[model samples]
Target chain A: MAATTKGDAGRSDMPEAMGAGIRIVAWNVLSLAIALVIWQLASRAVGSPFFPAPMQIVDAFIQLATRGDTTGHSLWEHSWASIERVLVGFGLGVIFAVPLGLLMGLYPKLYAGTRAVIEPFRFIPPIAWIPLAIIFFSGLTRFAFLIFLGAFFPIFTSTLVGVARVEPIHRKVGIVHGASKLWILRHVVIPTVMPDIMAGMRVGLGTAWLTIVAAELAGGISTGLGRMMINYAELIMVPHVIVGMLLIGLIGFLMNEVLLLIERRLFRWRWQVSL
Target chain B: MHAPISLAKVDVDASHRYGPLTVHDGLKFSVAANEFICICGPSGCGKTTLLDMLAGILVPSSGHVHIDGTPANPKKHSISFVFQEPSTFPWLTVSENVATGLNIKGAPSDQVRSKVASIIDIVGLKGFEDYYPHQISGGMKQRVAIARAFATEADLILMDEPFVSLDQPTREHMQREVLDIWRHMKRTVIFVTHNLEEAVYLADRVLILSAKPARIVAELPIPLQHPRDPLSTEFTEIRSKCVQWLHASH
Candidate 1:
């Protein structure tokens, strides 16, 4: 029976398993629909100026995409602005954080000595730095600094943890193989900790988006999704507000999916294990 | 291809003054080329420590491990080692793991690939080349480890109970596979194990060591042919002698 099963699996004529793919997409769409239904019902029952029905929000989204009123900017324009800020800030954060994190991880004494200082700084929220950032930098740069601060700690901490957690046996294996210290770091240490780094990057991406929105709402930036959302809220254009929120959710989801796809492809070896 | 590896007047003395305990004291041995030597004893015999010294993973306090009449160096890829555990890199596929040493030496990509393919085939892991270490069974992972050691093209391969984790059948199968690979490759192997039958079956000569602060107690030659039958009279006689020697020591 096992041999026959293997034979069938090997046959190119047989169709690949499409069931798992269908199930995942169906589940996601169904959950989203359920959430929208609950949201719509709540909006109608409350009858509040704050909450708008799903259809009303959809109408607002359409207007923002086409008409571009109140904020006086199109949805695409705001999205591009937000995305650009995130990319710049995230790129800088990764550049600075990874090397520092690796150094800290490799040297225990350094990590120990700085723990007292790092702990308190890590707890300081990115939004709390908005006032200081504004005073420090002029316009978009201030917002970028906020995003960088938001993303930096998580990536740094996760990288440190990943490097520290590299199995001793793997290091021993490299040494036994006559790998130089640099070779060990480049091949064994880096690849071993990649899954953790990818996870950290995912978390950092979310934090970057959150900080971008918050920084824009702090009213320094002239153009951003958060600025548009706030402007629409003040004008009582409920649809544009909902549109902005939906756009944030959609973009965040897409970015996360992209990261996840990269993770899956790069670490296919990891996924082969059942556990 | 090269002169036999010889250890002359080798004395390893490692001691710590921790109130009243002396860990290691004055140990000596020499191994020849193409020698399938098995170092067997009860647990805590420092068999692993001896193997580590041979592989140059650890340095002896007062002696040297010479490979082809030269002192062994950890920085030199003169020796390959396989631990009892699955030491194949979890992040690399079977083929990639096997070719890692060659890649580290900056060998050409095509040569490394071809060597890896051949070794994989030799170890009966041809179809599982693309599988990661974790995807495979324990026995298969050990095979990958063996294949990796063979692919390194080192003159000496040191193994510490390479099949200790497998079931009896799988262990026997792996033992045979290892012998076959060794015969074809003609590399010197120093296998450390406690299993008497395994030692007699695989080794050209068995070096039995005493319990603690291990010293070589006896050296027995197994004049059995290749693909040794464990149920054969000669195999049983050697096995009983080893069992008797170990039990008699206690």
Candidate 2:
């Protein structure tokens, strides 16, 4: 829609979202083209068996997407497996972390009681827990546990900070309005911190995705992107390994975009600093 | 014999200290039902701190606030505090902001709608009800604040220099708006401001306080007519007297 309001900075023929979309797609294509050219030139000059040209990696990826290739499963299957682990781990992390974090933010005493346990545990790397996770849970649950460990603390800490950042005066307004503790949490506290919570979910999901790939290699999982890369590397299939790495990066970008879309839909009132 | 109406009170040597220095001490006062009172003092003399104490946001180290002989409590009596700073919630539109108190109180949807609309009109914000805080100017946000305060019809409204941030013209305009709402609603209001003229213009009684360790220095009563002419002899006489007390305390 062409804006009728004054002082709107006037519009071009193109809608703002469309204009921004064109610019982003143009930049992405140009950058990817340049990178592919550089990789091809570098590989042709070096002439090493270790490094494959961009075309070879794309062919390997196409092979995975079309047929089972060496892994006996399509690329879709590996991607889906990785995504399932991330979803389960991220979902479990959010279900417990958000409420617990909010409670801790509201009540310092609750935070104090749990601080000692969480503080030391958060410092340990998620991959370090692979041994314990495998011992505790078998198969898929073990991989999920590693992803959960990666996702939990970031979401928890972000929620805690966001809740604590709510303006004191806003709470006073709720208090004076006779809003109950529960009512205030729902209406006043939650809305104020929602943007942060959504952002944390995006971050936590990304972390879980990254952790899941690493966990798959160590957790004896045979059907994920990480496991596929390991299997190919053992066979000295360099192009296949590069294909797995690139797919992980592409999928990660797509997941973040999905979360950003949701964040924008939910928090319309929030204004981001733009160019 | 029982009093006809119960009002709120603040007494019992209420004071605050920052380490060694005291901000207020022996600050005792009481307000009558439906009265418009102003606590006037020098700048940074803890006028806002006094309102916070009454609103239960800040608990006085020693004294207590009472409503109808019971300690002043938000759960017991409806109390609203309007801060001097523009306190409109940015995420909520004007109508939503005004409707919040009523919605929290569990009013019917129709009642909330009507009350919000009526109060928005009363505060001269009918058209801007859909506007967010960022979409409007500072003074309009003040109107939203007023509408929110009046809509609640709280037993007591504590205002800590609510219009002090506006420009001179808008400040005067808002002062009259506040007086109109206070008169029509007949709700007890304890306004805190550093300006003597504003105190004389709006308050039925002005509680003048000392500079530091602010305590009630004097209580000046104003029987002046409504829509008071600032240039009139009566208004200036009262304003000057309040000013003298404020200066002397400083």
Candidate 3:
């Protein structure tokens, strides 16, 4: 009886559930269509070449897909460049940050001792390190370094908070079962903090993507959507620049959606929705 | 397996203090192997604190707890627990949660699979083994906790008011199931509860404690056969006796 209530808790009434979903989809489409129409009219009225209308941006998007960018690199190539950097940086950040965060969380004295060193770097924006990155590193290393800086803090902090917030009973359960320290760390601590770690990784991916784009925009990278945008802007091809911006926004949204999907699948036991 | 394992003889002579406030004042007790003991006390009487001492989660300020003539070390003796809260690991499915203790003890995969399968069956959670904790009702989650504790095959199992959160009917139902499991497993259990009927129904003997800075006020043996009826004259007689002793302590 209780199980049925819990299963029904978040669901709409049977008759209304399907209707509600359709209504939501219709409303979203209508809202976006209305906004685009308004923007197109406003841009035409202004008649500034730099402010391309929505249709012009769409035309440029198709052109980029078929004709390639100013440097002859296709749209897919630019996107993959930025995406590969984000994944590499984000992956490396997670590998190092999560274990470090877990260790710091488990031992308070270690966290306290390292706070002075870690806290300062976290406050510094990734963009501010561009000059240093360019000077000390070359090629992919330079981009990876900046993107790593952007992604590392969120993942580390989230894991630390996750560890700290772990239920005392969870640890006691492990201890009572005669779990060794390593055993408890693996079975109890890691599993208990998984949701938080996933949350951190999601946020870190966003920041890493942002940092990679910024680094590409700052130049030295011949590829990526950001570099493609700069190349078009230099030639004053406003429509192509708008296309690059739109593509970045679309990809970021898609990336976040992918992570959200994974989160939903992995943590089906959690009560609240991430959104 | 129905016979006692002959290991879990617990001797506790301990006192605990949280700064200036004393929680257990020279509290001393002993539990025999396979004996089902219930520690009943008033609110804020530190029944959980006593269990923590027994579990080795908290060390007594001034005395020792020995299991089978050895010092109470969780690493040395297989001690399992069932907490009042919903403690099934949320990330693990029902079967995985039950297998936790055995997995930690490095039991072979085949042994873990069979033991977990049978324990889940005993607890009436056979079909729900693939489900997560949030998918189950609170009573069902408690059953999982019980199954996990039993599957561990611990020398001693500590239950701190493990059914206090359930509805009355569910609580009574769990009490009967717990008795059934105890009969088959023969693991020494020290259950702590404030409910008089619960203490009377489940325990071979009940230890009643006084108010703050608690001490054992009385120790009453149930002496009744298995499947004791709650409405029977003998059951109420002992319950009233416990109430009198509890009131007198205050």
Query: Best lDDT goes to which candidate?
Result: 3
Candidate order by decreasing lDDT? 3, 2, 1
Quality of candidate 1's docking, in CAPRI categories? acceptable
How far out, in Å, is residue A174 in model 3? Answer: 0.6
Q: Tens-digit lDDT track for model 2 on A1-275?
A: 34323223222333776888899999999998999899999999999989899889888888888886585888888888898888888888999889988999899788889899889988998988988887899777887788888999888988999998888788878886667899889887898888778878887888898798888888466788898889888999999999889889988889888888877666645454111
- Number of backbone collisions per candidate: 0, 0, 0
Standalone chain B TM-score for every prediction? 0.89, 0.93, 0.97
Off by over 4 Å in 3: A1-31
TM-score leaderboard ranking: 3, 1, 2
Off by over 4 Å in 2: A1-14, A47-49, A273-275, B1-28, B57-64
Model 1, B167-199: lDDT tens digits are 998988888888888877777888899898899
Over the stretch A168-187, how does candidate 3's per-residue lDDT look in tens digits? 88988888877888988988
What DockQ does predicted model 1 obtain? 0.46
Instruction: Write out the backbone clash pairs for model 1.
Output: none
User: 2 or 3: which has the higher lDDT?
Assistant: 3
Q: How many Å off is the CA of B182 in candidate 2? A: 2.1
**Candidate 3 CAPRI level:** medium
**What is candidate 2's lDDT per residue for B42-92, written digit by digit as tens?**
887887777776776667777676766766677777787787877778788
